[model samples]
Target: MKIDDWLLEILACPACKSPLRAESEELACTSCGLIYPVRDDIPVLLVDEARKPS
Candidate 1:
């Protein structure tokens, strides 16, 4: 499922404790520049699995 607008208010970056925005299929943290993947309708909010900024 897609991330709901209300969920954005509570979802924070697991790495930097920063705010996150819903990208195409992931959650992107502007502060840390990390992209957390969304798989099987679940957000994989893990730093180790997150994509590094390019």
Candidate 2:
């Protein structure tokens, strides 16, 4: 999954408005313990759809 650098730069966690770091196939919030999934290169940033850090 590839998201544009510019877009990723501006993308933040919907939950805590924290910066996100690109992981295998997800984006992890730096502040909150939320892991957002990337489906078909699209970041699923919905808070309800986020997975709590394990």
Candidate 3:
């Protein structure tokens, strides 16, 4: 499922409050290197749920 364009534009990274770029099924924060997964079209922005950069 795809997030709305406006919503995507407004969504920010919960960790560093940086803008997120849309990936295949996740939103990635370029600044902090956090990958937030989208579950059922809903973005899980919680820091605890984010994946760390390898």
Candidate 4:
């Protein structure tokens, strides 16, 4: 699912508090490289739920 531009603009990484960029079906942290999943169009910002950058 695609996240809205406005929401993507405000969404931050729960771990590093850095800005996130929409990537396909996930929101990836620009700073810390944590990949947050977008489930049902809702961003799962939990640090435990995030995937480490590969």
lDDT of each: 0.88, 0.91, 0.92, 0.89
Q: What does the lDDT read for residue 9 in candidate 3?
A: 88
Candidate 3 per-residue lDDT over residues 1-54, each given as its tens digit: 689899988999988999999999999997998999999999999999999977
lDDT over C-alpha atoms for residue 4 of model 3: 88
Give the Cα error of residue 26 in candidate 1, in Å. 0.8
Deviating ranges (above 4 Å) for candidate 4:
none
Displacement of the residue 44 alpha carbon in candidate 1, Å:
0.6
Measured over all alpha carbons after superposition, the RMSD of each candidate to the real structure, in angstroms, is 1.1, 0.7, 0.8, 0.8
- TM-score against native, each model: 0.88, 0.92, 0.92, 0.92
Q: Where is model 3 more than 4 Å wrong at Cα?
A: none
Write the candidate numbers in order of decreasing lDDT: 3, 2, 4, 1
lDDT of candidate 2 at residue 43, scale 0 to 100: 97
Task: Please give, for residues 1-54, the per-residue lDDT of candidate 2 as tens digits.
Answer: 799889899999887898899988999999987999999999999999999999
Error of 1 at 21 (Å): 0.3
The TM-score obtained by model 3 is: 0.92
Residue 30 of model 3, lDDT score: 76
| lDDT (10s digit) by residue, model 4, range 1-54 | 867788888888888888999889998999999998888989999989989988
TM-score attained by model 4: 0.92
lDDT-wise, the better of 2 and 3 is: 3
What TM-score number comes out for model 2?
0.92
Find the 10 residues in a row with the least total lDDT in model 4. 2-11
How much lDDT does candidate 2 score? 0.91
